[model samples]
Target: MDIIEQAAKRLEELRRAGVEVAPEPQPSVGETARKVGAGSTAPADAQGVAQSRRVELDMNVLTAHGILTPDSVRSQLGDEMRVIKRPLLHNVSGKGAAPVKDANLIMVTSALPGEGKTFMAANLAISIAMELDHTVLLVDADVARPSLPEVFGFDEERGLLDVLTDPTLDLSQVLLRTNIEKLSVLPAGTPHPRATELLASEAMNHLLADMAQRYHDRIIIFDSPPLLVTTEARALAMHMGQVVLVVKAESTTHAEVRNAIAAIESCPVKMAVLNKTTGHVDGHGYGYGYGYGYGYAAKSSASAART
Candidate 1:
């Protein structure tokens, strides 16, 4: 069959299985901002401009519209989660993207919980998978609080935790495919006796190394726990080639952001993504110009939730 015919057949199969595989994400506040900026004729430095653009996603759109979450679990994650995707790609490329076969590791982290790190990771993975021809791997490295499986509505039958504890499990068995084409997932796996130890183990290192080798054109993103909550985030950060710090507006303290930045200094951090923030909040009404039409955000908040 031709490529179009094959794609149509695949879509039909997925639909028959009740898999929602629409190519577009809910319209994001950032999308409009991007469109507005795209028309500019100014020749700005790519790196400088990329750093200023925060990675943003609409979590409310996902939750209200029933879009998938990081853990694959469907829920009303009230706050909006937004993140920049290009900065992430640039960050990965800087870490020696030679050979195009070594899928660089990206750790999405936050200073505190509820700052939308997992949300950012999941959506960013989805965005990358959709935008790039390369395959994407979203790894739930946050074993202490595994959310990747629930976000995508998949169960952690065998994942990082399982693979680390038992070297016998085939990596293919744990690498689950998602509704999004070219997006595979490695869940945190079933909670083990020593989750932290497993993550820090040599076997875990080997496992990640092997996966990178196998999926050369792919990007692997890790949804890790909050840096302040546990040492796991810091430990895993060392292994990653790039770090995308998700900082919540108002909620994330300045000190916390600084500390988080300091911790990630070892790795070449891609620019940080400010998330779940509004320009103004008054009596349950939020007004924020995410450089996108604020009106669109309200409409999308309702429409994208069920999508």
Candidate 2:
């Protein structure tokens, strides 16, 4: 099937899901400033600030796993990510075409589990950090089934949920500063059964505004759950500037992908990635990998039929 047609099918799913793609006015700056600008670290000897801890990530382990090789390494993975992130960086810096609202906020998800969305999200954040002017904030948004702890070799730590649940909590308290200098992580904290509801709450919106505004130089990447398997991702998508749906090459049925895209139709910008293919394209052995196209075409008029 033509990959553009596959992307067309993905857009159709959003229509069926009753998602709106129209743009809304951006939130006022004052409404968002309070939640942002805490920086990567907390202040020392602040009053009543006894509970603050920093988490460290293992770069050597990640390198061994191929999740992170040096940016200068001449490899398919490095080159591919470079292509994948161009439009994203454009969206972030507003240097390409038009500026995207909340452009700094990005979510990586798939049609279902075991599709490497988490892997993609992690690596994407690290890859973005490789840039000279950008920093990365990786959030494990899959609260119910988070994988950041394992992916980054960090233990259970306080994170996004802790602040949402407790009004007394400050975001600076939970934000983790990694040894990577440019990369920081916000893990899914203590699981909550009402993860979906929490993500959709008013508090979440305000927090997202703050996150979007804070660290104007930072790109936020959320590793979300499979669209068809979890409600949490749908809620999280509302706060994001861009959505990247990872479709496992031959393994993911067209119907599955269509459904996944439909779930997040309301998102203003969405991209589809065809993952894990075996081929020798672009003069290299690009095996079992992915390449995506921005839903560069109109999103609302997309159409497709199930076989």
Highest-scoring model, lDDT: 2
Off by over 4 Å in 1: 1-83, 91-103, 280-307
**Residue-level lDDT tens digits of model 1 in 102-154:** 32687888888876677667767776776545578888888878876555544
Tens-digit lDDT string for candidate 2 (1-307)? 4434533443443334443333324557875675355432445444434334666666666754446644436656766777778888888888856678888899999999876787778778888988898989998888888887876778888888776665545666787887776888888887766666666666676678878876667899999989998787888888888998877666899899888888888887888775555544344445432221121111111011111
Q: lDDT for each of the candidates?
A: 0.60, 0.70
lDDT of 1 at 232: 71
Question: What TM-score does each of the candidates earn?
Answer: 0.63, 0.75
The segments of candidate 2 whose C-alpha lies over 4 angstroms from its true place after superposition are 1-42, 45-53, 69-72, 281-284, 288-307
